[model samples]
Target: MREDLRYLLSTFTARDRFLLVMVVLAQFTSALLDLVGIAVVFPLMQALTGASLEGGILGRLYDVLGGGSRERFTIVLALIMILAFLAKAVLASIILWWSSGIVVRLQTTTSRRLLQHYLTEPYLRHRDRNVGEVISAVGQGAQMAHTSVLGGLLQVLSQAMSIGLIAVFLLVVAPLPTLAAIAYFAIVVFGLQRALAPANRKAGLEAQNAAWASSHALVDSLHGFRELTMHDAQGFFVDRFDVANVSQAQSARRANFLAMLPKSVLELTTMAAIALLVILSVATGSEAAALPTLSLFVAASIRILPSMVALTATLGTIKVGRAGLEVVVRALQEALTSGVDDQDPRTTAALPVTEAPIEVQQVGFRYPGAGRDVLRDVTLRIPNGSSLALAGPSGSGKTTLVNIILGLIPPTSGSVTYGDVPVRQSDQWWHDVVAYVPQDVYVADDTLAGNIAFGVPEDQRDDELVRRSADRALLGDLLAELPDGLETRVGERGSRLSGGQRQRVGIARALYRQPQVLVLDEATSALDNETEHRMTETIRSLHGEITTIIVAHRLSTVRHARQLAFLADGRVEAVGTFNEVVSASPRFARLVALGQLDLQEGPESA
Candidate 1:
């Protein structure tokens, strides 16, 4: 356990290392002030007993203040003591305030780093991880790190100073009792440390597992809630979630019960020690010769006990915090190591590409952990100023092909070329030149203008250009109808708008970028016939200006394209003009014969 903590703290960055040092130093200062406060009890006792402060730590402080004036120095000594007490209070408050700020900064940095890594990691990494695990690491990990850093450093300082001060006073008054207190505290802390290590490890695993399970249950059920309701399986999901939560609660309770054991023992041991000291002081008549010694002993015990208790509590918390931080450190290390192969591969600027178009050559891909390839031996070319429509049956790998082009997923074999350069290390390359509109459009809960210009730089955005794009997308009239025009808020996922309106907003977002390559993955399938026709008209108008790839289910949507490719069984069946493929391929001919091509047409027209 101690080794784990050493590794965790040592692994912190240089800035964090310096912060830790400052926290420990501040804690030491606060501890010194507390010890100084404890020293006051001895002088107050002497005043009550009519004894003189002639030979003690306080007496020395007084002599230094008085310059050897033994007589009539009490008044001056009293005033000086009061000033010293106030000074200690002020200094302690300052250190505590500083430590609090340090802790805030530490947690803030931790949260930002984790969130950045999460956003930038490759898509496959997220596929294997649970949303809950990532969320828990960022949320709960920050809180625990903040608390442990502050509590651990402060207590270590407080307890060590208090023990040292009390031990010195006890030795001066009586050696045997001092030795006994030191021995007792050492054993208690050691035993507490030993007993808590296993529990800490267990708690870390439990938190991770429970968070992951809960997240899976929540996301899966919500995403598939309609399906589950149709199949009457909602009760089953609830039962599973309940079981997971109950098991996690039980594990937490057990861990808590184990942590409390050390405190119970320390409390009982402290009470016994105090009783023994009182008995010895009375029986041996040590109070008569140096009755003030009893006050010093009592004062030291009073001050030291709370510090020791705080130390024990924080030690337990530190153990748990260290375990949690190990998880975070491992995640950060993985992020650093996993996605570093892209350096010096390729570069795509934010500005438009002046090179030739993209070409795919013999690209083969299979999902990780899957038994069969989704796309096999695929070869295709998209010219600089021509559009290609991908017409395929469901499960025919159209989405996988799109994902490859976007750099969201890497191919298992073969290479993709942009102009004459092989696509490599092109981070956000698609964003640089390609604007993608997926099947399910994402709508932000912000102004209509904000959703349309999602990726455009604020300073570069021209309102006139944005308005033209909206008109091209057939969404100009809708935005004008709203009270705030383009500034009106769209509800979550554009829930307030019709399906066709939402699809138009998505089209506007894509067109706003003025991308060189625009890929529409069934983006307009949700729209009505009129809206779909308008969208296709606008798309065809930019045929030479932008290279477009449309994944189409409705053949009517692709009749205007220069070329059409029919995909079936994860391979390209045929590629040619609409009538050419229908005449050559029986699958295409059957679809045409059945009038499925004109799905938007009424039955009477068919």
Candidate 2:
């Protein structure tokens, strides 16, 4: 627990730590003021009851003020008590504002850090983890951990101090009643802790799991909504989400009951204690003799009882939030432990990446925990200006090889180098040199120009460059049809655009980067046959200008490439021209017959 707390705090920035300190001081200040406020009532009560104020510090103050009437002195003490409460209220407001800063800072900062960690993870890590789990951890888990766990801790600290200071003040006023009240509340708190702590912790963990489940069900189902509707299985996802939500609600209900139980239990038990103290006081002495003590006790109870209930509730809430805290801590620890290949990804940016062949040297890769290599002894080279078509049957390590060459995944037993320098050494410049377009293009909710110039600020975008890139991707038709042309809003996730249009936008995005190495990972798969032909021509036009690597299931897409690497299973069976590959591998011959490679008008492969 200690180690986890330290790790959690380490994620907080120095500014957040300073804000936390201010909150602590505010709580302490509020508690101290409460003590003063409660303590002042005792003197005021004594003065109102006609008790002699001619001997103590009150008498000295009265004498210093020319022995004012008892009424004026009583009024002065009452005013001081009012001022203290007023000050506390104002300070409480300020503390709330400061507390919000810490929570927001912690949530936003930690969420961003986790996001960066996930984004920078090697590609295989993404493959191994569930998308919804990562989504929940980065968004929901982060918010809950900050709002509940850290906020609950603050509540506990603040209330505990209030109780302690008030208890001390009460002890001085009436020792026996104070002692009995303290003992009783302590017993109740201890009993409640034992009864509710395990349940609260369990409920918290249950809530976390339910959140994960519901998040997974919702996101996964929404993404596959079309398929679910076609299969008439929408209720399956609905039921799954309902079950998770029901569990989440049940856990929250249990926690609420536990928190509320203390308030009532403490209320009745405290009222009983106060009544007994009053009865004993009156029975054992005259009412006049007991008035001052009774009055003091009543005032103290008014302040202390609520703090005690709040302290108990706060403790229970902290237990509930502990589960989320554990989740957040584990995620952060994983991100830390699974270090990136490039310690500082930008450190080698200044080292120039010379235009030379991209070399794959004795490369062998096996996914983590896999038994065999996906690519074994794979040696290949693509000169500065050449196109290599990665062709294979499904699951032939074609995509993996593309990823390895693109530095998205590192080979387990080999290294890729650019112009004799290791790729890892020039990762930043490597990124600037390469641009990739996946099979399913991701379009953000932005204007057409913004989508083409993805991640570029609106003010910094070059209108002409956006237009040129879009034209290169054959988006002229799309641009002309749009009412607002380049400025038209693309709906969320490109909901307004067709799949092929989004793919074209992705192509245009890659083109906008003006990269030297272009990787199209089944990038044109969504296009119609005619569109694919045109795009293939566009790709062919870039021959000997931009070194292009393409992974394609369609033979027409790779018909005119300079080189072809045909893979079978996880091995590269042949690396040569189209006719040479067809002669070398029977699979290529079969593909040629199936795809009618010779029927297409194309240049002879290099």
Candidate 3:
């Protein structure tokens, strides 16, 4: 428990820790109030019977009320008790509200921070992790951490303090019964907790794993909807989902049952203690003398039993949520400790500079856990405002090279630099300078204008830029067809749009950035020949204005580029103008022939 708390605290900011300390202190104050409320009960009951007004709190009150008019004394005493109870209730409610707000706010902030962290995490970390797991950590993990971990711990502290204060009161009133009851309750609560500790730990882990598995299964099934529909393999994926979901459900059910067990056991024990105390008082022929003691014990029992039940439930919740809490804590820790520098570069303004060439100096890269490098000693230079086309066979590392040049992935050896600054060092300013159109564009369920503007907020979106970029990407026909034009919702993943339309949207989004460097990886693959040609022209128009890097799927896309590189394996075999590469390498010639391009036609010189 100490270690778990330390782990969680380490992930929290100084402000969070300070707020948590304040919450604990508030809980302590509430416990003291509870003790005061309970303490006033015994004397109040004695006053009601008019039996002992000459001792302790009752004596003090009697003297204060003039010790004369019995009715006045009773009425004033009752009001004092009522005030004590009201004070305790009010403070309890306030503390509950405050603590709840703190927990919920922390959860909201932590989840948002985690989402941002995962979105901006090092690309290598992303490649090595599952997307669904990241989602789980941000969603379910945050909920459990706040409720089961934070709320549960709070419950235990408050209840434990309440019980301790009540015990102290009982000791002052009647020490023997207090000692006996504490001994029995402690043994019972401890035994129950110890018995279920291992089971709770196991169930917590199982539930966490099963939840992640179910989420991953659901994501896979939905992502492969087209394939499943065509092959009638939906049942297989559903079965996997069912297995994971059932495991999660069963683990939760077991944990809940275990959590509730102690409540029932404590209730039974409480009733027994009440009955035994009564019987012993009668048996000892001391019913009259022990009436005050008996009342104190009974009131304390009523309070302690509930506190014990709450303590048990909280302990159970903490045990059950510990595993998920660990995942959440780690993600929060990662966000705090990510070596992206102490300051967030994403918010920094770009440096004022003229066109600068992108230089790839002996860059090499390998995926984590891979035996060999995918790119090795690869070097390329894209002169400012010039276009470079990448071409090769399927496994020729064309996309990998483009990604490196785009600053999406760091090289294992050497470096990629934008002008004088390393791309790694350039950070968000580099992202601002470059625009990318991937083969598979991610389209959100948003309006056409929103999609074109991409990450920019609606109020901040420039309508002129959207229309210009859309027109440049040849989206005029699609816009004309839409009833609402730019305002029309695209539906989830752009389901309302065709593959070619989606690609065009991707192109428009990239163009909207008005980047200094534009990279297209198979960006024209989905377009029909006429559209592809028009799109090629659109790209061609940007030449000698912004540096263009193209990883072409179709050989024809590179025919008119300023320069072309034919990559084989992970190395460039030939790099020159299209005609020059064709004459220089037989493989390049064969590819051009395969695409049915005129072998003798030469493009405009770079």
Highest lDDT against the true fold, candidate: 3
**How far out, in Å, is residue 559 in model 1?**
2.3
> Between which residue pairs do clashes occur in model 2?
none
List residue ranges in candidate 1 displaced over 4 A.
1-13, 43-62, 67-86, 149-158, 165-174, 221-265, 340-352, 424-426, 455-463, 596-606
How many residue pairs of model 3 clash at the backbone?
Answer: 0
RMSD of each: 4.3, 2.3, 2.0
For each candidate in turn, the TM-score is 0.87, 0.95, 0.96
Sort order, TM-score high to low: 3, 2, 1
Residue 227 error, candidate 1, Å:
4.5
The better-scoring model by TM-score among 2 and 3 is 3
Clashing pairs in 1: none
Instruction: Give candidate 1's TM-score.
Output: 0.87
RMSD in angstroms, candidate 2? Answer: 2.3
Go through the candidates in order and give each one's C-alpha lDDT.
0.72, 0.84, 0.85
Q: Regarding TM-score, does 1 or 2 come out ahead?
A: 2
Count clashing residue pairs in model 1. Answer: 0
Q: Give lDDT tens digits, candidate 2, residues 1-606.
A: 456667898877687787788899889999898888888887777788888878986677667656678998888888889999899879878887879777878888788778777777767777788877887788777876887778878878888888889888778767877888788888989999999999988988898888888888888888897899999999999999899989989988998998888999888987888788778877887677778778877887888888888888878887887877787899898888876332544343553765577998988899888888889888889988899999999988998888888888888887888788777522688888888999989888889999999878889898999999999999999988999999999998898999999999999999998888899999999999999989998998897778899899998888688888999878889988777788899988898898766733445632
Off by over 4 Å in 2: 64-66, 340-348, 599-601
- In lDDT terms, how accurate is model 2? 0.84
